[model samples]
Target chain A: MKNPLYLLQRALTYLVLIVASLLSVFPFFWLLVGATNTSADIIKGKADIGGALIDNILTFFERVDVPLVFWNSIYIAVTATFLTLLVSSLAGYAFEIFRSQVRERIFGGMLLMLSIPFAALMIPLFTMMGRLGLINNHLAIILPGIASIFIIFYFRQATKAFPRELRDAARIDGLKEWQIFFYIYLPVMRSTYAAATIIVFMLNWNNYLWPLIVLQTNDKKTLTLVVSSLLSGYYPDFGVIMVATIFATLPILIIFFVLQRRFVEGMLGSIK
Target chain B: MLCGGERFDLARTGLARTERLNGWMFIMPALVLLGVFMIYPILWSLWMSFQVGRGMNLSFGGFANILRLTQDPVFQRALSNTFIFLIVQVPIMLVLALIFATMLNDSKLWGRSLFRTAIFLPCVTSLVAYSVLFRSLFLADGFVNDFLLGLHLISEPIPWLADPFWAKIVIIMAITWRWTGYNMIFYLAAMQNIDRSIYESAKIDGVPTWARFWYLTVPMLKPVILFTSVISTIGTLQLFDEVNNIPPNAGGPSDATLTLSLYIYNLSFRFMPSFGYAATVSYVIVILVGILSYFQFMVVRDKRR
Candidate 1:
């Protein structure tokens, strides 16, 4: 028979794990339940799912222009993600494949730049965007984020695993440099691209601070800004706010679940 | 034969030149964007910090903004509040993450994937979405208060957003909830790479579980722990989204949750635009990150020897 102490230890482990799992998952349940309950029932601390989800969704749609904000978010996120992956991957590949003292120093400088908070850069960036007359434009949001330092760093790390023999073979076959990159490197590193796509897309989608500052017009705002503005209203219907929150969170959640393994690997790729 | 050798040498030089050009061609786009967006803005902000300004009308006043940072009560409050968060929350979150990682690292644990997925789910939500959820959940008459009262944990409902202390508590709780699992993922990844033989050897000896954890696992995971700490430190120093969106009055109930980034936002945008002062405030975060990161590295280094 197993020792009593070992059994107790196992029980304690399960107890702690169960408690943690509950705490971690409770907020999501609260979010879904809150979406279905009216403001009164939510305030009354009702835990069970209610039947007001349709009403809440309708109210959110009525208060906000759902299609425009979603378009803004989607357009910016997709364009930004595509450009970030393409540009950063090329840079990452070049950084790894080509060795030079000057380029390595520049790469080091970029790493240091990662620590420079966005708060510090916002004032000047805003002024620059204003001068270009790009204020309230989705391009303003997409342009600056296209060369993300963190993504470049991640791609550089991932690129270390790319096979040198393939590049050599491609060169021997008379494939041009850019041609090899387009045909061989791109397809071979599709998993890295997948991981980076999810990450960059999520960042661009949920981006708040810069977008909040730049996008002045209601028609130009993204879903994040719209949901935030919903709460600032006088009797923020918890139900409606929850609906909007769910709408904002759903796409990223779907992408994350679908590409869950790559997402985790992508996160690991950075620190490695 | 000499003519043929000359031609081959020329071809080698031409190929090297083309390779160099290709390298630059590949990186030029990203470099140009970074220069315009990151490098130029960094220099401009540094220069702007020295220019005393209101709105766009400005004059260079060296040390003026820095002097204002000294006397400004709001700046001091934001600075102290940020430090308090860094000191208290970072350790709590990191320790919890380390513990959860150690526990979940066990292959024998049942439902391990479920627990891991659930814990990690919070990190996927947008900052604003989670903030709004937390705000509603922690309202004075909200579910948290109702649940606590039902459990007889407290006699009266807590004013989570309205009171200063409770508001800070709520912000800390919110941050911990969102980030602990994120840090845990890093530790978990690091833990999986550690050789299982070491733990097995320790088990064969009389070393207890806690001692094995303290002596073996913690030391092995030092680099990852240091990495997560620095990232957490930087994140806390720039804490804004939750504070900005969670409280009824962004950093409200007497600025208890006011962080440096939010203060910078307020100075530049919310109030009469003090662009110079805000730039100076932003530099405070940069400096804090530099200093704290140095100390963290130093501490880790000293422990190694």
Candidate 2:
């Protein structure tokens, strides 16, 4: 089945794929190598690994309140993820199962809102936060994001694949709607939850602009805000910055790896 | 039988009422949250856009901020820079993603999964981390410059972040690197769902590879392409993280990389808190996205007819 032309095409595909992959993955590798080199060496464009990882880590920890900031990010992300999934998924399920003309219109409106840039909403949201006395509060970060339109859309789309027969059988067996959603639907859609968890958590963790505005003090900063401000310092250390960036990136990376298969499946479910 | 039928009908009606109540219950939390967080803020911002203000001292001056927006040179710069990035970068990224996706969709391709994973990894990368990596990599004496210089591509190192023109290129490259993979995943997913038999029959008809791709794979991927383009348009217009992080100042080198989102940030936070003017700039983004997306959908629809 393989002719000369076919072979040439295959070779060309392989070459492009390889180059693209390297280009895509090289920065992460550079991040790792940069963490191991001194700031001076990094400035000199040193590519080789050095034994400066410990020093970089120490420098980073000393410069920042590592535990408090880490906890701030983790708390916000986890709480936001949990609430978003619970609220949005419930709405999604309802939108699918209990469809109505009015509800459908609401759903369309939500999609349009999703397109409205969050920047557009920032000032008023900031004002509302101020009114509620939530300035410099982590709740300010977590609350606004809980009703995520994208997650709702994803869950609604994914719910299309849920079997109607299961719901029917549960109804016949005396299961209540909420009970069926909890006992049956929730268990079945664990993979979707896993996928959404990674995404929502990542977004919350890397949330820069809103958190930057709301969380005012040094002690309240997330890793993202902290890292960004770190760059603006009088003498920014790339090695220390690398170490902090790696820390900031590590949790999401680990979550991605652990749920990689489910994440892809989750994406497939949404697009369908 | 008549009595039984009447009872069944009553029960069904009762169940319908219950379902309606349950539906409201399920959606109540989201709706309430949206009301407080999204809807209210949106309305307030809309109102704010009509007012003239600095800090908290505000007065309703209808159309003042809108008029200011017309005359604001920084807004003009940011608007033009945004369009340049949108026009230049979006197509390049989308086309590359499409090409990569098609090539990878070949079932006979070896190491397909590895390549897919590698390419897609960039999208999940932390914005701060990637921005830092890119800034360093494109430094005058950094890896990218070193490699280019070694290959004799240029006689001197390019001032990627320092220069106005090159700064825009650096931001584009950064975003393209981060998001091209995300777009490719969508295309790849869509391509897989496409009937392979179409390609097989086309091959049997002695269709050239390029023709088969152009006439076949592309038409099938239209909906997905449209969806990505609209989403990408919104994302690009809201481009902040890359520009804010890559440049020395958030929107720097004389606002070369300043975007609408960044301008809004500057007006509100950096420049004595012109919330009204900031809100005005924000609406500009909304209008642009609205228009571009409408145009994109129209184009897609026209192609179908």
Give the top-scoring candidate (TM-score): 1
Task: Give the per-residue lDDT digits (tens) of candidate 1, residues B1-305.
Answer: 24467778887788878988998999999999999999999889999999997999889999998999889999999999999999999999999999899989999889999989988889899999999889889988889999999999999999889999989999999999999999999999999999999999998897888999999999999888988999998999989989998988889888999999999999888889988889988988888787876776676678679
User: lDDT tens string, model 1, A1-272?
Assistant: 36898898889888888898899889999999999999988877788999999999898889889988888889999999999999989999899887677899999888668788999999999999999999999889999988888888887888799999999999999999999999999999999888888888888898999998999999999999988988874367889989989889999899878888988887677544
- Against the native complex, each candidate's DockQ, computed on alpha carbons, is 0.77, 0.71
Which run of 10 residues does model 2 chain B get worst, by summed lDDT? Answer: B1-10
lDDT of each: 0.89, 0.87
- For model 1, the stretches where C-alpha displacement exceeds 4 angstroms are B1-11, B293-305
**In terms of lDDT, which candidate is strongest?**
1
lDDT of 2 by residue, B64-153 (tens): 888888888989999999999999999999999999999999877788899999999997777877998987787667788888888999
